[model samples]
Target chain A: MTHFEPISPLSVLDPRDRGGPVQPLLTIQGLKKYFHSAGNSWFGAQSVVRAVDDISFVIHKGETLGVVGESGCGKSTTARLLMHLIKPDQGEIIFDGEKVGIDIPLTEFRRQVQMVFQDSYASLNPRLTIEDTISFGPRIHGMYESKARLISHDLLARVGLDPSRFAGRYPHELSGGQRQRINIARALAFNPRLLILDEAVSALDKSVEAQVLNLLQDLKEDFGLTYLFISHDLNVVRYMVDRVMVMYLGSIAEIGDGETVFSTPVHPYTKALLASMPSMDPDQPTREAPLSGDPPNPINPPSGCRFHPRCIMAEAACSQKRPALETTRHKKSMAACLLQNRDTPIPFPPIKVSGQ
Target chain B: MTPNQALETQPVIARSPGYWHGVIKRFSRNHVAMGALIVILGLILMAVFAAYIAPADPIKGSMLRRLKPIGTPGFPLGADELGRDMLSRLIYGARLSLLMGLSPVPIAFVIGSLLGITAGYVGGLTNSLIMRTIDVFYAFPSVLLAVALSGALGAGLTNALISITLVFIPPITRVAESVTTQVRGLDYIDAARASGASSYTIIRVHILGNVLGPIFVYATGLVSVSMILASGLSFLGLGVRPPDPEWGLMLNTLRTAIYTQPLVAALPGAMIFLTSIAFNIVADGLRGAMDVKS
Candidate 1:
């Protein structure tokens, strides 16, 4: 077993010395993850699903960055990749100006970054009691068992579960909401600087979701934590995030501050996504589908802009080349679309949609 | 509502039952298993106290009393071909019989689980290498494999035990491998990995508990099969040698007297059948009790 020097207090308190406070807490550069699926025919080539295709993003300190996409759009894959739960095939992840697995060892990097899974029930070991599960990470990271136990109890209480009532209980003995609280408590046990929550509140009912969301909000403030929140629920994303990144077919279509992106989405895919949110006003029910067809098969995603087939404003030129993410009209936002890029010539005049 | 408020709203805080307590509670409810357990316990006790319980010396024999019918004076359950008391022989037989039948399983369980779990958790090339090699063992029928291995190793109790243990390992390994592969894909494993748990720690702390229950139930079911196989080896003159009072060996020695005193001749065979059935149903009961879904 290799020995790692314990992280010093100075380093933990002031980790971004090289880049100072301006450096993003975490940066993902050209992260790609492809999965091979066996082709149906006997001699056919194995197809690769580009689950997360050369995506890049930054999580600034103390901000909740929500990643919104339809099912199969690779949001969960990105979250897993960021946590290093699944190794990215081609990319670098920089944490606090130090390259993970290079300047800092993977174990040390993981200690600073933790993840909460979407399936609260499946995320917990049924055999371990709540306290055991919560304390397991700290104990493995070299904390004494007694100290770990104390921390586990403190975290359980902080997460709103009475330590005495919940600590000895198994996962099956708790409600879904209670189990999710346990998962959150376990993630906080490391006192991680960054938390990648993959649809953390999506599985709960509305009331429970609000409670967990509030708990998450409070914890983030208390811990000075940065969050990479991934979910398909647009309304929830709007409520929980300061910044939002909309994805389509394994690639980002738009990203910006929550207010601008929700009100004035620059990318056609993001426009349709925002328009598709189930209207709270019963008088303004959605009369038309947002975009047509399922997401293209990731094994062979559509050429050029992946969303061209479904984009309401797509042109013949849109299928010829992929659009790079560039600054949009809103200085804080960026959108990846041929029409949004100033250098690209629009092949045809824009057709105005009625509502816009 | 806050958790404390929710707790106050609830009727009561019932204590959650521990896993083992639940297993025992469920197992105790099974009438068939309970009966089988009693029978097995009786057999084990008989084996343990054979010396004090057997009325006559098992090995001592006389030609004059040979082939006496069951219930004959001073020789209850009749005498064997060499005039050995059948009841005394069967009581003494339980010791070696139970020993031979039960010892191979735990040894196989440990070795098989280690190999299988390694192959399953560390997948890809390592999985291919270990699993493909184990699959080769499946090419030979277990009965034939046991016979051939013991035959090659030459006749002895140790040789027979070794062959039976080898025969049991492949199936147990296959079960362990499949279960571990399933467990390795679960979210808890991913959560553990994300928490920076070493592979060894993940396997031990997360995967083992989930996989062990099914593997143990499967291993328990194999015990009866092992007993029958051990008995078969003894009957074929490959296990316990003569005058050792093993049920199978006793049956083999009493074969000629079957036509004359058929009831007495069948006593050892009856013991083997009864003991094996008891083991089998008890295993079934355990499987039912341990099933989390049930």
Candidate 2:
């Protein structure tokens, strides 16, 4: 929201187009994953859930790109697709300017990219000791046992875990936050260039979340790594990422500099998400949800614009014609909406918060 | 190193005891299971040392001492219908009984688990193909299937063991496949896959540790079932040939003398019941202790 925070007045931190033609490290084109539902009855039609449908984006080296959306928006699915955990029905993922697929070999792409899952306990094998869990990636990728063991202990120490105290402990013996740290350490064990964290910090306590976020920033700087950070918390995303991508029912609704998107959000769905975040200011008045009712079922999504059913600005044309993502005058902020109305440019709404 | 880094440095901590230790500790607490385990251990020791521990030669039958009562001189538990030393024969029978019960289990566990883990992890067409084929064996009651197969294969200890092993396989596979299916969806599996681990590696290293415990516990339960079936095979004279001191065969041999020497005749039956029940209680204890959910 325009008046949501004191940081809104600050300019964008994203590396812009004016910064001398830099090529993106990874480029995704037309990705889609549709899950076929079981038959309703003996003869009922099998519906399909469009988990990720027709999305494209690029990530540059050493950049932290945050993906935010409500549940069922396919935020986690996108991460799995990048990791190649689940095959996309249709898409081409171009990494380092080369087409990455059957020919280039997935193991080569996987060696460079690693993902940290949201549920920490579920992400670590319950049977493995902390040392084995961390070393599993390296040992399988051809590192010798002794060298891998040394690397695992080094990673444990780097992630703030005392190697001697924590190395032999299993996942069940550790707390939620400690396990999350181990998850991060395991991702870094492979010496990956790109780390995709799918809601990695969303499960931690407030204080632990801050510590983890700080650890991530330090790791990114030290390792010179790029991150595709996914989270539901806009506040944390605002503090951590360079650019942000807002998804709605598996399609990108807004993409731009993190500051611009969070401070002056143009898409209707993005505005609603910001409003949903609990404000610390007791004096600030609560704003009613801009759009109500659960998101349309993904199995049979609404026609045209996926957000049309809940859109307050929906028009007759909204139901029949989709709006393409277009850039604004800021050169960084972009949104997909039929209500651009350039002359007045749909006045940016003031968020009801105390600091304003 | 920096000060903060040094401050967070962990000291060497003693490694705690592992999962099996906890299972043993828990099992020790269950009195029924402990008693059963003790009995089972005794039975195993008897089976191992039967040649030395037995009071007299088990095979030689004496016509003058035929049907000797309990506490008779030269016969500790008295003589059997053929005037054979009952104590010696029962002790010697321990080896064959345990052999019949346990021999089929490990073979079935290894083969069934392989089929199941593979089918479950590889899901869809391969899963259907393997599982459906295994299901054909599942169509009949396990005992009936064992009996029919062994009957068709002809009577003998080897044929009985083979048929019983076949009978246990489908159920073990079903359990392994279901448990594997459940473990297959956990986040660590996807994490392992993303780490560039091959499917084979996933099953052996990652999935095996988690699913094997529950499957093994389930197989322990099958051990008792296998023991009973093996005894049944010998009772019908399809296993452990005559005068070999097999408990089941002894039961068959002593049936005619049941009226005249009732107490002596009941000894073999009592041994069969106690051993099977001991195995069953032990299986129950192992299940409770090995339960990962708890």
Candidate 3:
């Protein structure tokens, strides 16, 4: 058997050199994705679907950065862009001093980054055995030698499955939770620096989702891993992430520490998202105001602020110019709303901290 | 374990063996498909052992045996126009007919799959060029195209095979292209790309693995059509020449003996029908077996 020396130049560089103290492990600057639909007679005009429009975020080492939004807000597209699953039309992805881009080799990129997909049932190859699916990454990257069975068993055990019993089984034979665990195990087998969980537990039942979330927390602690967790479920994001970024219509509306954002959301859209969640305490009063209208068509988003049509606190400036994400009164927190501006003494919505 | 206990646990033990096992089990339940598979396999075996199975030399003839009726004591299926033993010649004819039928399918499949996969996966100019080329060939009817190609290539078994293979390439390419296109859109292929798998690796590992099963089943179905076409070419004297015991050529030679022994003339036609039917059955079975949705 021929063995090649591990020849990755990026691995030898010190991660701290890329950013200052408290610098992010992964920094995505100005990420954008525009999907052009083929022009046809039925649809008179050809348009670009601005899926992930100039979104930016930083993922600190050993912390989970949760990206939350309703569907079509480009949360999934952001994850894909960061992972380089599809090339971003314009952006720079810097991972640990290495300038990561579309041209980076997948085998080397796979060693540092991995993704756990949304649908556990479809994520795994139905044709492969459970062991084979789990071992695919390690085998492909040449991480394990000839003792594939032993490595597969170790991975299966790490994911809390009995390798002796379940290793030979196929994906359809396993339950949804089990398949998801196998998927996670497959990603972890490569010892990746960053793991992107793209609604990893969304498809599982409530109890199974909790279990998987717990498992994820444990795995992160054990491996000292960074995560880009994309989810629509606010409850799960609160439990799993250190910081939360709210996306609306392919742009970040607000970003801050999880507790700060949950307790006192600055953006109207963020507040609306939190307010919509069903409260557990019967004694607690609910916000009566409901967010009106569906998300704007991504093909032709509203002019100026994309959320102005849906936002309750829209002003004259909101309709004319886009609100850039600027820092507010809270240190290290930002909101993309004219209301957050010092010059604008705009009356804000009453701060409602229901469950806290 | 007791027999009852063992029986009870069988379903649990079986679980899901894998995707391929599921496909096989689904295929087995289709009776019409299974019968076709058996017939195809039987024809293949007959073709492979044609030399040992044939009772006499296919080309040799004697005046005494000429015009002998089928089911006669000495010559069970009687003799052809030249007095060649009908049973011996029919058995020998299996070799040429099956070869002519089966050989062109793989050639067409390889050419078509490459073209189709490229066109479907890589959109824009490359796709447009390959698809338009395929359309040009598809514009002509398959039989007419094959006949023209054979005439251009000049008459021979190999030339006829080449012509028929060309005739089938467009349809096979279309099937392969569509399947590959669908497979390319799957999430796993994107996952593979994210993992830093090269374009070649993505195509070979992720795309081809998913698409091949459907393409293979389609190719198997085309085998029967290729065989019949090959036989037709032979009957027209553009394929296997005289003295070579081919089913189509046998029909042509025995056409004159129809008045004297109608049953003997029917023998070659019966062989062609049985062989073609067997192939079609097997192809149907494979289609049922490989269908993931079923």
* Separate DockQ for every predicted complex: 0.42, 0.57, 0.25
TM-score of each: 0.91, 0.89, 0.86
User: What overall lDDT goes with each candidate model?
Assistant: 0.86, 0.85, 0.81
| lDDT tens readout by residue for model 2, A1-356 | 11111111103332222232265767889899998876563477888999998899998767899999989999999999988999899998977666777545798888778999999999999888898899998899898878787788888878898877788788888888899999998998876778999999999999999999999998887666789999988899999999999999989999999999888788877887777777778887545544466788999988888888877666788898888888856768778877754555544433222210
Task: Indicate whether candidate 1 or candidate 3 has the larger TM-score.
Answer: 1
Which parts of model 3 are misplaced by more than 4 Å?
A1-21, A39-45, A101-107, A147-149, A279-289, A341-356, B1-35, B55-57, B60-69, B72-75, B78-84, B120-124, B253-263, B291-294
Q: Which stretches of candidate 2 lie over 4 Å from their true place?
A: A1-21, A38-43, A102-104, A342-356, B1-34, B62-78, B253-263, B288-294
Full candidate order by TM-score, most accurate first? 1, 2, 3
Question: Which candidate number maximizes DockQ?
Answer: 2
Top candidate on lDDT is 1
- lDDT string for model 3 (A80-174, tens) is 88777778899888776567744454456667888999988667766668777666666666656455556666777777887666777877778
The residue-by-residue lDDT of candidate 1 on B1-294, one tens digit each, is 997687767644334677788889999999999999999999999999999999999999999999999899998899999998999999999998999889999999999999899989998789889889999999999988999999999999999999999999999889999999998988889989988899999998998888888889888888778878888899899999988899988888889988999999899999999998998899899889986557
TM-score of chain B of 2: 0.91
lDDT of 2 by residue, B1-294 (tens): 997565456455436567788788889999999999899999999999998899889999889899988899889788998889999999999999889888898899999999999999999888989999999998899988989999999999999999999998999999999999999999999999999999989988899988988888788878778878887888887888888988878888888989999999988888888888888788788889876456
Note each model's CA RMSD in angstroms. Answer: 4.9, 6.6, 5.6
